[model samples]
Target: MFPMQFALKRGMKAEMPDMDIARNLDIEKPRSRSNSHNEILTKDIAGALLDVIRDLKSTLEDSRKSLSHSAGAGCRCSTTGTTLSTLDEYSTSGPRSSDMMGIPPEIMSYVRTFGHEPATASDLMDWLTEFEDTMEILGLDGQNGTLDKRSVVARLALKGKARKVVLAKRAWLARQGQQLSWAEVQKSLRLAYRAHIPEHAMESRLCRFNPQEHSEEGTGLLIQRVLEIMNMGESHDNEYRLFYIISTLPDDIKDILLRRPCPTDEVELIGRVEDIELLKVSMAMNGREQGKGRKR
Candidate 1:
């Protein structure tokens, strides 16, 4: 008998105190009792043990039947063997699925689709921001997997001419025995589309930005737009960008900002201006509230 079978039989014999079963299984016999008593006890124990074994067999058969009925449900099984084999296969075999490369539906829906003709620097940058956000949300932003896999999934997020450009670039890399990466795809797309803009145009847009016209957009967005245009231009001078941004601000806020020491960078300048704008709004609200209280 197998070790498991032997152990199970021994356990039953030990629990029931059956002389016949003990002798059959080579277990040590218990002390002898009166003949009549031994006969009664043996019968009762044997009946109970048979009932237990019968119930166990019935349960296994029920399980086997259930598994057989569901065999077509992509679960591997074997009906030609013991219950153990079927159980083992049922527990272990099936298609292994993973979400490591899967993007959530919500994230996909939120990300903007690109591919329209005449992609501008601002449009590409905005789309790139959304793409980067999606990558970070999926935890694929770092050195998490092969560049090829990342590139493939990243391409799926794009459509139109943008997709075509990336696919062509990927093919070119393949010819050189190289795989395209997400970073390389981004660079390629930018160069093919946004890089050809005239520097004068970018500078012209920056210089003409009017914060007053875009007041409803809030100070932060206005500042961000200025910075984006400045980035597209050849000039890297923060002072020049700052000068243009300050010049565009409403005179009331600009005068207040001009009196303060100059900020170290555009970021510092943005923070200071936003704070000032918020303060101005708060004071205006307070003034109106005071006037209403006096009338009441």
Candidate 2:
């Protein structure tokens, strides 16, 4: 009887080790290489999504170019053999004849900067607000209006129904905490015209800009104006510190005026004063060219 009891106890001890090994395997399973692959899988999915969005945007723009000249005849049918209905059927209504005029070059430039995202009316308003804030930091608000952007945008968006739609959309986005792209904003403007949103609400006290008279000249103007403000400060550090204040501009502005474009001209102008390495080389090259000109 004693020998049998000892045999049973040894067998139970052997099985206990196997149970611990199984428990450890279960706990550590998620740490396997398969889990590591999930991060890579997520990145691939994001890349695919962006590519699809780009394709959709390209198709939309191509369709717009073709249909804008069709004179209300409606779009051409797809390969599926169904007639493509007028955008008005899906959208609000046909745009008025007057609404077919030209889009501003600055507006076009703005939209092109965003790549493939669809533009909406709200995005244009936000851009106006952003640019205005940038100008304000440079002390370029010659009109000295209130700093409230909603008020400012409402006043500047005065181009008729388009402006009104932009303002309302912006207001809605602001309430919803949603941001729109420049391309999206432009798309919304075109779509709004089809949707038959009334043009009357657009004629607000704030939506009344005349760009020829009120526009900031260009990027150079803003830079020059900012330098002037910096020059007025008492201490050298105070002048240098204005940069920290300007850095508060949104990331979108930074992407445009700072990152992609590199602000080469602006940087070169500053390099003349600061004489950093790249700037020094550029200035030396300029000097050599000028000397050759003088010799001629």
Candidate 3:
């Protein structure tokens, strides 16, 4: 017998190795291990599921923070096409977008400067053009050739019907492999809301603004009134436009103008009309200052 092996005392049972003892004991496997492959696979899947759940929770928290910090808050949309039909409602009937909390302060403030509410796409385009010009003037588009847009669209009166139209445009633009820019989006809005003026109606309105009716009015006031009406008609003909302005002049002024050799160019004629108005303005200002000096 080797020195490491000790002989047992009399009547002592032979002690088996731990391996043999475990095999004979019919003991359950260690809690940390499993003999069944299905159980191990199940555990692995459960662990992976837990990880995904944690990641999703974290993502949701970040989204909440972003919405709270930005204009995207409360700006929810459904995937269905319900939002498209109501596009004009928010810009017209709904509350002012400038009054909303999530709207970017700059965009919201700029939108409120519109002379007319953007009830149609054309009105919105005008607003966008003005907005872009004002932004350029203020140096918002940076030296890096990029602008700090900062959810500018979200600040627009774009909820409900407007949002739907935007979404549809987005898909169409993507299909054409076109990148969506702020100006482009506004262009789409314009297409959606463009108004077609009838030729007959425009001509009628232009004719109805009679210069003779305003003969009793101040020279400046009559010119201003005529121009405003012309704008409402959206007339494009320079010759036609100049003729309207000239026809509105008081008979005395008209006679004086008619005596002068008319300029060949339509632009020159418009300039001449503007010059007469300016002379009237100068005379009126001189009269005001003279009255003020008399009081002194």
Candidate 4:
């Protein structure tokens, strides 16, 4: 054992160059990284791996194309059990569909800001589309099996202004053992809350359109809200709307707009308002930069 150890040591010494063993002892050999760093490197490696994977993908795609007689195909498997794409579409590994979760604050904000007024069918549809967009972004859509088309409609009736007639009927159905769907709830809300603004009411509604006084946010949001309410009244005269908006502008923005030579055209006038306000923002930024320079 001793002779074998000596022979092996001598062979190693003869074959290898001289080493600064003491200096190297403090030099870190590559230590195992933290899980986060490993994940980052793993993603980089995966990105590079995609090129090779794409070639394999293209071959299978081409083969599928040939099978379908050179016609294009759907991404997922059809009723005939043919899928023509990368493994990612078929991959059931990694995270489960339900395990994935993302809920934007906008959806919660929308949910919270209900019961303010009776919405028209048009208004409700627009609101539903927005909230649905957030749901889709969050992966809480029908495809993920976490939500259905009717789920959004049901949610609206459950939360806000439609809660009186729409929600009451929904509760009544539940008690009566009638299984009502989201579409049914949505239809009910439209019937109950669709606003038919009379000729006289339009002016009154327009007059009542006050800007939201956000303590934290300044004139930008107030101006935006005023613009939004102007659109909401459904009075088709853009010229009237434009001048009315100009007349109603907050003091700071109005002062800035008044300084410019106003365009006779209402469209041009509205354009000038937006353009000049943006200019003022740039001017303010320049002022800040000059102040910073002076301080320096």
The prediction achieving the highest TM-score against the true structure is: 3
Please, what are the lDDT tens digits per residue for candidate 1 over residues 167-271?
Answer: 466456556655355446545544434333335454346445555544434445545555565465544343344444544555444434432222323344444
lDDT: the better of candidates 1 and 2: 1
List, residue by residue over 1-296, the lDDT tens digit for candidate 4: 11222221221121111123212222223334432221111222323333323433344345434434422344434332545342322323212221111112232232233332212222333444433332222232223232232233233223333335544654565566443443444345334333322343433343344432322133454355446655555443433434444444443344333322212233444554544344345345456766898999
* Clashes (N, CA, C under 3 Å) per candidate: 0, 16, 4, 0
lDDT of 3 by residue, 65-153 (tens): 44444423334323221222233333344444533322233333333332234443335444555433332222222223332231122
Task: Give the TM-scores of the predictions, in the order they appear.
Answer: 0.21, 0.17, 0.22, 0.22
Q: lDDT of model 3 at residue 114?
A: 26
Q: After superposition, how far is residue 287 of candidate 2 from its true place, in Å?
A: 30
TM-score of 4: 0.22
Tens-place lDDT per residue, model 2, 1-296, is 11322221221111111223324323122222232221111222323333433443344455454554553565443332333344332222322221221223334343333331214323433443433332222122112221222122222222233444555665666576454433344344344533552343322211233222222232223334345544665543333222322222222222222321122122222222221222233334355766898999
Q: Report the poorest 10 consecutive residues by lDDT, candidate 3.
A: 4-13
Q: Give candidate 4 regions above 4 Å deviation.
A: 1-206, 209-218, 225-236, 276-296
The C-alpha lDDT values of all candidates are 0.38, 0.32, 0.37, 0.35
In candidate 2 the C-alpha lDDT for residue 208 amounts to 34
